[model samples]
Target: MKSGINAIIWEDSANKDYGMQNTGLKSPERTRPHHIAVLAYQGLCLFEFATVMEVLGNRPDASATAWYHLDVCSLEGAQVRATGGALVEATGGREALLSADSIIVPGWRLGPVPQEITSALLEAHAGGTRIASVCTGAFVLAAAGLLDGRRATTHWKYAGTLADAAPAATIEPGVLYIDEGNVVTSAGSVAGIDMLLHLMRRDHGVEASNKVARMMVAPPQREGGQAQFIEHTRPLKAAPAIGAVLDAIRRDPAGEHSVSEMALKAHMSTRTFFRRFKAATGHTPLEWILLERLRLAKDMLEYTDLTIDRIAFEAGFGAGDTFRHHFRRIVGASPIAYRRSFQTV
Candidate 1:
């Protein structure tokens, strides 16, 4: 699985010629062909918007694929200028959205979102269309009120703004993305590529998405969440009562660790330690440790073929079963399943 030959592939003889002449073939007509519409908001990120076009628009023809039909829709038949002063022209406006099987909002520049775009997003969501956003575009989705009470992420730099705008939402500052089924949000800039490719995989299965990734020279997958890249800016002068304990945990996750001992080390009362841990990590002590352990387990799984038992111990889990449980809970897949799917190959 560590080799490059592990790519997943799928092909159908029926769609070999790429045309849907068989009107009676219900599956081909009703399902397979996805109509994707991308909202070309003003001040678009050239790379992010082009990422969608490259993957979905340049799909191979001559074979009957029921491939994607993509439309870049701007407002009122007007050409919206992109960031860095590039002009973008859409074939149509909201009409493209009304007909789309799904809609994507690519990253936008930081500013107030236009009301017209927000209203259309609400209408589409209410109508059962799947909606997603990339980077600052998540701001647009949030502005439309689609992210209320849902877990979402935007660029870490702007996560505070997103949370403030939609207090009903839970803000995950250092994550690649989060999928609340119909509504999904992604983190900063290029992470949008990961979210869109993932949507392709979820809707059309691995093979189709992989093909698109291959064509675009994008990685088929990038796992272990955006937290792996999150910097641990723990202070070095561990003098603060609670700060010392948190820093120690980072250095030795395999060591025996508990709040009582942590409080003792920090020379603080247990109750104070509990309150401060939450303030420090934006989560409970156990929640933070669990994520850290699972993150360690994922690294071992990716880099070595060590058995789950060994990984469990190295990751500081009480047992292999416990490690599997938390890994799946946090990462959304079993360790074995994740390895099979994402291990270098």
Candidate 2:
């Protein structure tokens, strides 16, 4: 940040524009997927694999204007078995990796990537294909010598492993994803979706990416740095009285629901409710409320045209300044910067 704003945003933005390719859903027969390849190593995280296929495999409505062609690649014609016993058919092998515009490696199984797999990845990198990984998939990339001297990230648990294996790569553990133009890496599991949606946004545009997210009935455009997931404290479930109070909290996230009044509503002594709430959700009622507010703030950032002040009120903050403070703390970015990065507008 010592550099000027222009210095920081310009060179960096151009590289970001390179690292990701967001090809909106398109017919394979039409745009031909720009050749997206998923490296289906043994024990690949199914959710991450599914995320890639679900995002990249679908052909757009014959009526829509874009398309993608997704291919599953493996080191050999080996039957790719996922962690949960699901068998995946890899239609292509190492040769397929060389034939892609983009290639992705999902988090590897509990051990190192086989040498053969690593070699294929390096050859693909040599061919100038954009490469990325989810979770420990970064290990595969690093093992192949592709990550050295680059800005990269992985599931925080394995970020240290990546740094140790490839001392040249600058490891960023807390962020959701990193884009070095030609190479990218993301946190484990769900961040894979965020990264894919980003690629779609880069290729097709905001409107196209949102359509796919809506198709899946999920939010589009979660910033790479947003919390992986928020744990909410539900009011006491065993106490029917307290259950009603919990429902009320969810119903009116923006309401002024004080803890003392909530205890009264549940007919519980304040001390008992406090203890139970902590045991149930691993957080206090206030902590849960803040997380919910952050989620709402994110939703507003993605879906609405509301002003920041209005979003603050809708998300239950006292006002704009308070909302900004909590948002920056929990979300790791300013309201405007978050919106600018994620919101279509």
| Candidate 2: segments with Cα more than 4 A from true spot | 1-31, 62-66, 223-345
lDDT of 2 by residue, 119-194 (tens): 8777777777778888788888888888898888777667767789889989876567777767878876777777
Worst 10 residues of 1 by lDDT: 1-10
The lDDT for every candidate, in the order shown, is: 0.72, 0.72
RMSD of each: 9.4, 11.2
Candidate 1 residues 204-291, lDDT tens each? Answer: 5667778878877887765445443444455444347667677677787777788788878877788888887778667677777776
lDDT (Cα, 0-100) at 253 in candidate 1: 73
Return the lDDT, model 2, position 170: 92
Off by over 4 Å in 1: 1-35, 58-60, 63-66, 76-87, 94-101, 123-130, 149-161, 170-239, 292-315, 318-324, 332-345
